[model samples]
Target chain A: MKEQILKNLSNYLELLQERFGHEKIWEELLISVAEYGDSDIYHNSIKESLEKILEVMKIDEVLCALDIITDKIEGFPKEDLLKYIIYIKNEYCLEKENNLREVKEALTELATPIIRIWHDIVLTPLIGTLDSERAQAMAEKLLLFIDANKAKYVILDVTGVPYIDTVVGGFLMEMIKAVRFLGADVVITGIKPDIAHTLVKLGVDFNNIIVKRDLETALKYVINLIEKR
Target chain B: MQERVVPIIKIYDCLVVPIQIELDDTTVEKIQKQILSEIENNDVKGVIIDVSMVDIIDSYISYTLSETATMARMMGCYTVLCGIQPQVALTLAQMGVNIKGIYYAMNLENALEILAGIEE
Candidate 1:
């Protein structure tokens, strides 16, 4: 994409210079606009490159270029400039959205981190609150991991979690059930007092799950279970 | 007259099924029958169906499999499904199949391990 942009750079800059009658032109600005204005996106880096333009070029020349493009100048080719602005604006919006989506994906992965703490055991330390989307994402990851690793036990640590409602409790149960289907036992540890109270009040059953007081107890219990088996 | 869809090899008391062909509704139904009969004939304690080579398993096919596992459970035989492709698993999970009455494993070895555990 960058190579393609470079190939068309001369023609595009020549056209702009001919239309605006600006003898001194900024090649980097045009390239940056074309480059960052395409599929690739690092919003801050693009903005920083734009800021770097102020250090090297005269501010008035840049302003004049902007004004002409924005249709402030008399007898400016109105249609083509409008089309260019529309295209750049649309591309900028799309690039920003892509950037946001990437951040969201990374955040989801970071939020529900699953660590293989030992042989036949994986530990997922739950952080923050749970929503349906986040819960489903976590469930998919956990289920696949269980199947791939042929895991024997999973310790879910929720000590960092602030609260758990009935909805959250349901999500946890569903995740546990999916893991069970994959033939791996799940041991959820580190339930806070508030979460425990919420769980009890909600009348959630603990028959299917093995819960321990802390991470240490959970690991010891799993080791013992493994040994006996 | 229908023929057998996949070979069912016996390893210890467990029947290992590697289903490599594409499964139409009829094929899966036949496979189900084959597995059930093998359970009775061999006194099979467990069945492991490997679907790694199969590319796709639609809703009907999955339903047939679930039913077969249920039937096997009633016959005092455990069913463990192994090596389901990632895409198929995603589709099944989205279809909201609980995959009840059946277990899952990573591969043949793991499936055998699960069956051995159940024996204990």
Candidate 2:
């Protein structure tokens, strides 16, 4: 079975090289061999020879070549070869999905850190898009940190947040109130004019909350409050 | 059962009423009447409603509180609400009930400080 497969593959390789160029044909052949090789010493040797023939190839080209080979190979169990291709495609897709999920989790942790900048003062600098899940996670994290640290003041720097919708606006209000309940005042900084407009249009009242133009002003105000105390 | 009465404590020239019980319609009305009467009797300059122990505040109660604050203001008393739980504030904001012109302090001490500042 292995000998028949290899003989058909090599014959098709030469036919592909004649129709396409030698350079393109060899690269696609190498990738196909690498993707569909069986776990046998003989198949491993076949793959090694194909690898030496090509430097690099696009995955789409290799998949295309596989489709052509499965069709052209006469009397060989085309079903078996197609199964191997399907298995390889599924594995690749799963690996890509896993990598994407890992990146998202890393970004979430990176964006929502609660840092204690001074005694009785903590700063939470939010960056990236504010979605409902991210907003809820931030609220839980900031509230827990304030209660645990006994922080008197929290400076919420939203310079990196691009915009706010009604859902996020409501969650932000909830977070501010939670901080106040824990006996710590929240100072919001770095609200862009556009965001301010959105909040107003959403009918969000910021009359009770303290807002600052920038982090510098917020820090100065916190320091003065501490000094006065 | 005997009718529940809200206590009004007089601190200096301010009438401090810490709402330790949950407020229903009758309780809120009774408290409002008591607060107005106390303001008139003591001639106090400020009224502090400490809501630290009260967990839930509905729209009706919120409206009542605002009305009571307005009434107190008319009778020459500054009404300050202190110790409103964070959850209550969030609920009120979500409910779209604006407690406008009513002052809030973090605690009773801060409420007293605000009243003192106003006195000065």
Q: Worst ten-residue run, lDDT, model 2 chain A?
A: A46-55
Per-candidate count of clashing residue pairs (backbone under 3 Å): 0, 0
DockQ of each: 0.22, 0.12
Off by over 4 Å in 1: A1-95, A164-171, A193-206, B54-63, B73-76, B85-94
- Lowest summed lDDT across 10 adjacent residues in model 2 chain B is found at B86-95
lDDT of 2 at B68: 94
lDDT per residue (tens digit) for residues B12-42 in model 2: 9999998988789999998988898888789
User: How many clashes (backbone atoms < 3 Å, residues ≥3 apart in a chain or on different chains) does model 1 have?
Assistant: 0
Q: Best candidate, TM-score-wise?
A: 1
Interface-residue RMSD per candidate? 3.3, 4.1
* Residue A171 lDDT in candidate 2: 81
Model 1 clashing residue pairs (backbone): none
Best by DockQ: 1
Using alpha carbons, what is the TM-score of model 2? 0.60
Candidate 1 yields a Cα-based lDDT of 0.75
